[model samples]
Target: MRFTLRQLEYFIAAGETGSITHASERINISQPSISTAISQLEQELDTQLFIRHHAQGLSLTPAGRIMLMEAKRLVEQAESLYAAASEASEEVRGQLNVGCLTTLAPMVLPELSISFMSAFPRASIRPHADHQEMLLNGLHRAMIDVAITYDLQIPADIEFTPLVDLPVHAIVGESHPLARHSAVTLSELAELPLILLDLPLSAEYFTALFMKEGLSPNIAFRFSQPDIIRTMVANGYGYSLANVTPRSDTALDGRKVVRVRLSGENRPMTIGFATLKQLKKSRLLAAFATHAKSFISDAYIPGMVAPAMGQKKR
Candidate 1:
């Protein structure tokens, strides 16, 4: 190959950190050396990988984005090949780039990270979280090796492995009249002001529940973050709908909320991992997936109660 692995590493560092200076600091290399590698890479590829921003940093162009994906896949494959050859008798170890749905980050990512790293000390894990679209984009770009998110709208290029089923529930403050009920239905719940989660595709899922019942939700507040939605519901601003329940009813602000099961024929969302359909699962990725499936079960998700005796799976 005309370009060396060292050049690809330098380019990846600069692309991730968005700055030649920061990339140099991160890898303990000189800024000029990093710049030279990137320049040489661009010359060989005949494409501008980054658009320089004065005093700010660099931004990856469309071509840069495509190249970044292939670069990551190549580097990961190379690392896996070396590990397999050198540690044939040893434990699986290498780098992992994992992502989670933004809503699931606060609820589950920390526990999964701590558990995985504790078991595989030699393996490096980088965890990231964003909305559904960005997470899918990351997967498609090979920036994230695997993701744990609800089955909202997965593209055809991605493959999802369902691990847990989380049904929608109504969130309300202790003082709300519906708080006394064990479960609430959409017809009755829709009469009250709704504090919408308002994330991409997520908003549609929540609202569609009421739409199926021929009812319209009276939306009082809309927020993209789940914690904010909980805080709003805890403070009695309005009732909200959620899938992942934190262990505590109290929000980060210390206001308490209650989770009431939703009644009716609404479909539950499947929580699972997403990866490129064609990508071969490295030992590191397989090991992580095994841990993740066990970490997420019907019995132990925070803020979520155990599934019903005859609960269905999708």
Candidate 2:
């Protein structure tokens, strides 16, 4: 039936409150209007949804259960539409949605977000954290205006810009033998049980480091979450290689995990900004992108990096 969604809302409120008077009060409508709406809805559906009892409220029939579910869904959808409209923007003063890969968000976003707000005080930032593919899909669907992710598997619809290059370090428990060394050979890391990051590029880069020296890593485990892997390493589970050097005491916990130079292998995840190729960027988005790149270069990348690899950071 093509009845108005308002009818469903009224029915749901009446069903929930069990009183036409209460439903009218809740929806700010007159009791007579509420009763008429309910009657019209029941007539349209050709079902007795509520059984009216003398000197008491109403109760639902079995058919009412099905209608109630649909009514709730309609109400929810209506509320969502209302919210979307209320939160809509007329200029750069609207909502700015952004997505970033997990690895980059932890390091880059806190600083960049603050800078973006300073630049565009009117816009609100919504950030999503996901893998590279999800971030790209978000950009393509206009769910996100920008993303910060590893420079790998870029889509043609997205324009990639290098934010900075962070050096990949060999992280180990402070007590590990290599932790004392300023520089370590790949042959030294080969004998250790590797707790690897699940990124294919990372896996290949580390594996190649050992293979070039004709030694194999005793890989112990693979973990997707950096925090989980960091904890495992702190507990002396196994060694891992990563570019992110968490500078604060909170991240490393007073150097329980020591980050050292990866001497023989130079592998870094080139962090960067990306956006949709076809869509016109908002001033807010352009401002955020510029802020993000500058923030990374100042805070994370130690030296001036070579022009970033657009699709690969190997």
| Candidate number of the best TM-score | 1
Clashing pairs in model 1, backbone N/Cα/C closer than 3 A: 245-303, 246-303, 247-303
CA RMSD (A), model 1: 5.7
For 1-314, candidate 2 gives per-residue lDDT tens digits of: 65778788688878978988878875667888778888998889889999997769888888988899888777656644543554464334545667877765775566566667777676667666777777888788765778887777787777999866666678878777887888776777877888988764556766766777788888999988888788788778888887766544233344477776777546566778888889766555665676676666534432222334211333
Which consecutive 10 residues in model 1 have the weakest lDDT in total? 305-314
| Model 2 bad stretches (over 4 Å) | 1-91, 199-215, 249-255, 298-314
lDDT of 1 by residue, 195-274 (tens): 99888999999988888888899999999977888888888898999887676678879878988888877899888999
**Which portions of model 1 miss their true places by more than 4 Å?**
1-90, 302-314
lDDT for model 2: 0.71
Candidate 1: global Cα-lDDT?
A: 0.85
Q: Global lDDT of each model?
A: 0.85, 0.71
Candidate 1, position 230, lDDT: 82
TM-score of 1: 0.77
Error of 1 at 191 (Å): 2.6
Instruction: Tell me each candidate's TM-score.
Output: 0.77, 0.64
